[model samples]
Target: MTSSPLPSGHDVVVLGGGVAGCVLAARLSEDPRRSVCLVEAGPDYGPGQQGWPASLLNARALPRDDVWERHTAFYRIRARVLGGSSCVNGAWNTWGSNADHAEWTRAGGERWSAPALEPYRRRAVDRMRLRAAPDEELSAWASAALEAAGELGYPEVDMGAPGAPGRGRPLLNAVDGVRFNAALAYLDAQVRARPNLTVLSGALVDRLVVHGGRVRGVRVILDGRPSTLVADTHVLACGTYGSPAVLLRSGIGPEAHLRLNGIRCEVDLPGVGANLSDQPGVFVPRSPTPELDAALAAGEAAGNLYVSRMLVRAAGEYCPDGAWNLHLLPTAGPPLFGKLAPGRYEAGISAFLMKPVSRGHVRLRSADPCEPPVIEPAFLTDPDGRDAAVLRSGLRKAQQLADALAELAGPSDPVPAHTLSDADLRARVGTYWHPVGTCAMGPADEPGSVTDGQGAVYGVRGLRVADASVLPTVPAANTQLPVLAVAEMLADTLRA
Candidate 1:
């Protein structure tokens, strides 16, 4: 990695170097005429950080200085690198269907509807060469599972077409046996070639530089020095909790919430930190195959099936998308996972809800930039909610898929017994870690919406949010693809 001087000024200033921020910065700087500056809070990504090998992508394995462990009252979320979470995420590339988008729009997400964002969808997928089967052969488990779903009358939607549903193979951004983060795609030679783009790492933004109800720049602490960087336009891509925390520090949020924290309101966007959303997943470990055992022994890119059940509630009716996706991961050895003795392991099946109705919030804890934001996700807290119901459905689907593999392979194979119930299965699941919507984008009239359809902050001129935080609802797939689509849309809007 190389180092550079902080830009004195630029036409556009993007806060946070996550996937969305990086992609937008690169796209905005495509024109030699427009200068762009990006500020990242962590150290630059090193050589080993790139490429596959899930073990290396763990938050614990990343350099301590480069990874920030934000501690909230609940739990800690890791993110403190130039590429943001993408640098550490599993990088599963799954896209949602139009039906899924329509439901989001109907559920208070206006600009995020499927039809309205088709162009970005195409662009996001087209940007990379993603195939359903990169290993060139389907695992016996995957093959039997699809055939079982067909035999069981579960409509198989072709996941390749985001609008269609079927038992589809995992379409990954895992390129050449390596992990592809936003930093690689947006900040490679193309962005580097542009004299207009400047990236500064190890810069922790403290607050938005708001002046007379408008954003003028950002005040950050770089290397223990308090500095201010001004710009014509300011974009916050810091992420869900990060963006809201910064805004609250700068006095933008619900009036009561702000005043209680002793902050004078500059922008009373009540929804600034409301409507939090995320999709949590769980893992199912199979007995290891000889190949899987070998990969686990050698430390390679292990894959899995990331599947979700699509369900919606509106007008007292229920709609199921009847489609799901799975990521096939190739793993390192058992020594890394501790799941087995050196050779006693199996590939795993990771299943979760992609689009969940459970909502949460990101609020100021102590008005300290260093303090982690209060993240409260009321997961399954809503007993009468659809999020819980759909998650239950996902559990069933996951079990079905797992059961199908039993017939394809004998008891000696990877997959184990099918005696577990849905409840037993759900208890073993956790999160896929795609959190969004803390700063939802929609019309101002929408009570909990933060930014407008065009990615503009309500009541704050020259301020915009282009990241997963702006999503009104989590999509029915891995969020990296949708985050990229949102950035592509925002870039076009900025250019227009």
Candidate 2:
């Protein structure tokens, strides 16, 4: 590794140009005096959506390109682009229940409260250009699903902010089938024109230079050359999987685990890679009638065929009052993974356990920064089997909705989802892609707390983590909008 000389280091160096990193770099650089640098491992398409690839810009389908690893486990799918997962996600945005905020407030303080964060949430919404799915965007199947939810007594509620559990359309960050990613939203031409803001693309962060309990600089491999970039403060916005792996590689995690990887331990933060929580669910396939298939195909030809436009937030047996634990999603479109004969479509309802108690971990395979981390989602592995039970309840609820839509689409399998054995359910489980809680926030004295309420690393000065990784608990809804709001709030804290 070669050390790069700098007469004066940057005011702040953000070590991942994902959603949060884009927000931090943009907001912090507002002051002309503060020089900020944002580093990303992937290519930056530059400026706007014009220069971006069609696959990444299309909001109708989730693109597999620009991801960290291809043909890997579904749960491990994470985007490796300048805009992070925002560049490849479903473009849906929904807020969690009040119970989620309550949990966050307990772990972090009043700042995590919904009321306290409302301004930032609104800021994120405006910046991301989030809008409700238009009526024209709804296919015949989505329209039928909405009617079915109403028949089941699920009242309509806005999915964009805090509210009671009900059925409604989620806000979308896409406009006219174009995905407006974080990079395009935050780093516009005007922002990129700022001389103080530097976006270093195709630079992989090797590790941080930690000494005397502070991060002096970060070592990165750029264009096959190792160099150190000094900064007065270092912020980790590497998302859940990448952030913890970076810390472990820098010898800032558990002593035993670091030693096992042949890396000397610096700070023994046992929680650095622990408490990995994510939402898991199962999709119950339904055979669409000829009429339904034709309608979906027509909608596709019209360029308005969205797989999932509406969802129902249903309370499970284990859910608390005024809160939901399951998301019943109705989808009808081309198969997400494989091809289907023309005019034939895949239709199903997925039951996702929103608030699961099962925990997982991310461990280092080796000291090499280029190697992928060992990620175990550990879904439905709670000792009391609560996650499995709740998921079953959700499945039963999904069956009810499907039954209501029997005229349009019928269950493919004779067996009901609720009747599936635990082993069978485990084999069929899929993720919602909302992973969090790896670098959880809490008091410095807490064993499982990697950062404090304001995102400062517990034992390391001049270092912080501001992303999905620091969220102590995964919210009950999709994580994209919440992550954007979190970055906005943390950027304010850094400014203060």
Candidate 3:
């Protein structure tokens, strides 16, 4: 837990003290013999006590502090903190469906399937306190939305329960109105007290110190001072954006791109920063009634942190059964959201494409580690136009959800839905902020597989990527629960 100069060497060095890195650092340090060091780019509120930001403390809305730079068209929201985005994100916990992990089986065989992932899932679930809030916990607006959803045939049930279809109240990972982020969950008081584990904040890693095809250490800028950390094992949990950047700066990406960026190629892996995927979404906002506005505000003070109580899992008319897709959740919130800033108290349905076919890629803009690379999501670019079609249908679904609640949310003024053209929908869409798949995992020879089944880098030794970046495909869920499971599952292999 010391925040001073990091030890010169350790058994393991974990880059990015985000969700997965926190879990990895904690689990690996379990064995007293293993010395673990975790580096983070943001300040750590040591032991989650003093100096906690008000935005992070309030669960009513996710913290909107920008952690990374992004092109205006591709607004990639990331939380650069000790606990990562889990500290500031909407606390929606979902594991997607069994089908979500089926794609993983193609690369990692049964080891990556839902059944195989369950044990790790259980381990993660066991580690945290996650469950649906009491029905009475819902604000008046959320209550009305839930009832409206039920009337529209969406039932109340545990969406995370195995075989539980449709939607109910989303399970949250908050405790007593505060975010139960990675630091609080995995690096608890006892875990922090362990002498073998070291956590470093404000340490941004520039590149891996690689030699002889083996990763030896990391070159980091700790509090504006340059230093190198040597380790027996180096895990890149720098998240989708940061992790890939580390690889690229270390001369391990598309050879042509590396050369163009003035970085010498150490490993000409074409998939280092390719295959980026995220949930493309848009919010259908409306003016909130005076009653709902008061309730939304008052609920925050009463330990009712969220704007919504229930989520609607829709397969829509086009996709059903194992092919379940589309997520429509009613939102009632203040102007705290990053994209919805300076906004009035409003209520609306936030609909997103659950399994979009569109794909995107990330490319290095420069060899400098501090420079943000170009993130071209190319959202809604699928050839068949299915992605756009789904989002368009989602607008209709939101309109239906709103229509069911017209008696309550009947906006004092109208918003575009019926009048808005398909082109309008395309222009209004934003990110769900669940970016993943940059450092995708698969069989070594797979075209864009950056890591092997066990999360090992394809052409490197003593280095691996264990985070949202390694996901072979995007899970049609909130991703926090699943991402935690990935770290927990890999902890064992990493331990061995």
Query: How do these models rank on lDDT, best leading?
Result: 2, 3, 1
- What are the clashing pairs of model 2? none
User: How do all models score by TM-score?
Assistant: 0.81, 0.98, 0.93
Q: CA lDDT, every prediction?
A: 0.65, 0.92, 0.79
Tens-place lDDT digits, model 2, residues 1-496: 0112222378999989899999998999999999888989998998878899999999998899899999999999998988999999999999998899999998889999999889999999999999999999988888999999998999999999999888999999998999999999999999998878888888899999999888999999887888898999999999999999999999899999999999988899999999999999999999999999999988988888999899999999788889999999999999987888999999989999999999999999999989999999999999998999999999999999999999999879988888998888999999999999999998777889999889999889999999999999898899999999999999999999
Candidate 3 has which clashing residue pairs, if any? none
lDDT of 1: 0.65
Most TM-score-accurate candidate: 2
After superposing candidate 2 on the true structure, give the runs of residues whose Cα lies further than 4 Å from its correct spot: 1-8
Q: The CA-based lDDT of model 3 is what?
A: 0.79
**Model 1, span 201-304: residue lDDT tens:** 89988998788988877898888888888888998999877888888988888988989888888888888888887775555555555654553334333343
lDDT of 3 by residue, 328-417 (tens): 878776553444433246688878887877888888889887887788887778888788777777778778888887765764436555
Better of 2 and 3 by lDDT: 2
